[model samples]
Target: MARTGFDIVRSTNNRGGVDDFIPFEATMRAARAAGLPVGDYIDEVMNGTPGATQSTIDRLRALGVFAANPNTVLEIGPGSGRYLEKTLKECDPGRYEIYETAAPWADYLVDTFKVVAQPTSECSLAPTPDGSVDLVHAHKVFNTVTFLSASRYFFEMARVTRPGGRIVFDVMTETCLDAATMHAWATKGGPGHDSYPAAMPRQACVDLFETLGCSLEAGFQAPMGFASTEVLVFGKGS
Candidate 1:
């Protein structure tokens, strides 16, 4: 018998939980229902602001991201435009494109950034043509993508980047596996069943980059209250 959606969710959760599982719609609804400040919450989480927007700005600046200027940048899944704002301020790219699979969030990104975002359905990394971008950035986008799909995405990133361009993204580490478990509870189905495949392990991520002809420039583990997070910098090669 085929497994129901709930069963898939449950099994996936039981096998290993995930962090960064909040669907865009669910977050919007919760914010609306709580009458909580949507923009504030978004700024806090997406921007990495500690107490508020000012702190977020300060932290980003301290990270040296603002010092470097990228010519063109692509951000995958810029939920609520929080990271959108940060990228605009820090990267200061001449042209910016955001890729979002979720329609409402895509619309929200456009409204907030006043920039066009490519429909994820129509675009991909592999067939995107060569040297299309100077930088590719993804935040929490890889956590839900399966290892095989993640491999494809990395190839796409490599295909679009100039020989010297870079790809920057973050992922939840094994240390954050507990968060994955909690996320699994929200899933009702059995293991290995999800909208996307489960995330790849850290070594797997490193290997994927090497396989795609990119070199890991830097990697660091970040603390996210509950789990360990890793931010990686990849430089594309010819």
Candidate 2:
């Protein structure tokens, strides 16, 4: 059997192997090394906070993700439970389901947030019940995945979301992919340049949602001080 992207990432980092995978820390370091001023970016956009949780929350709100809040929300790849914490405190979802393939991080999140851990297939989002969740959110998860994997995840997100609910997520726009950053990542042998699969364009992402019976309400670059990121919000059509 072929190894999944998560498997390759985990295996490469273990047992004195190469770290060609794009973990959260390495990505942050690469961004900083590329002279993006990640700290200042986080502070200014995330209210001077140290993590991407608040920044994600603010971005979600800016995309009108919470317009139908107090509903169940599913977040894929909730690293360190920062987004989970913010959502619990702010979004107040009736139930928060997190899907993570990283075992250690998943364990930490489960312990810290006291939420259920749904089993996820390799390179795929877990099977969320149809029309069960009010909102689905993912942060930077799609950047590491292939276009096909992203399409599958988006379809799953649409399947789980209730009619009139929304899906909010972010990615590294083509403009955001700096050559200097890529060089650093290359030097580090990070997965940012791995052969997982090709990435889809921003317009293709919008088209995927629209074809799945969702309306793209908003899509734009999220300002993170020195760098710009892509954010998209989709509402399920009735």
Supply the TM-score for candidate 1: 0.67
- In candidate 2, position 238 carries an lDDT of 76
lDDT for each candidate structure = 0.61, 0.64
Q: Model 1, residue 133: displacement in angstroms? A: 1.2
For residues 1-238, write the lDDT of model 1, one tens digit per residue: 1222121111112111332334556567657765655555654554344444334344445655455577778877665665667568666677788776656667767876776777464236443458878778776567656555556677777778777777877675564567565575346433554543254577777787788777887776543333335677778786
Among the numbered candidates, top lDDT falls to 2
Could you give candidate 2's per-residue lDDT for residues 1-238 as a string of tens digits?
Answer: 1223222224211111222322545434545765654334334443334444566677677666776574788888675565666677666676888887666666656776777778777534545678888888886567656666667788889888889888887766675557874564456543534642233577777888888888888776654433445778889987
Whose TM-score is greatest here? 2
TM-score of each: 0.67, 0.70
Candidate 1 has its poorest 10 consecutive residues by lDDT at 7-16
Question: Quick one: RMSD of model 1?
Answer: 7.7
Q: How accurate is candidate 1 locally (lDDT)?
A: 0.61
TM-score of 2: 0.70
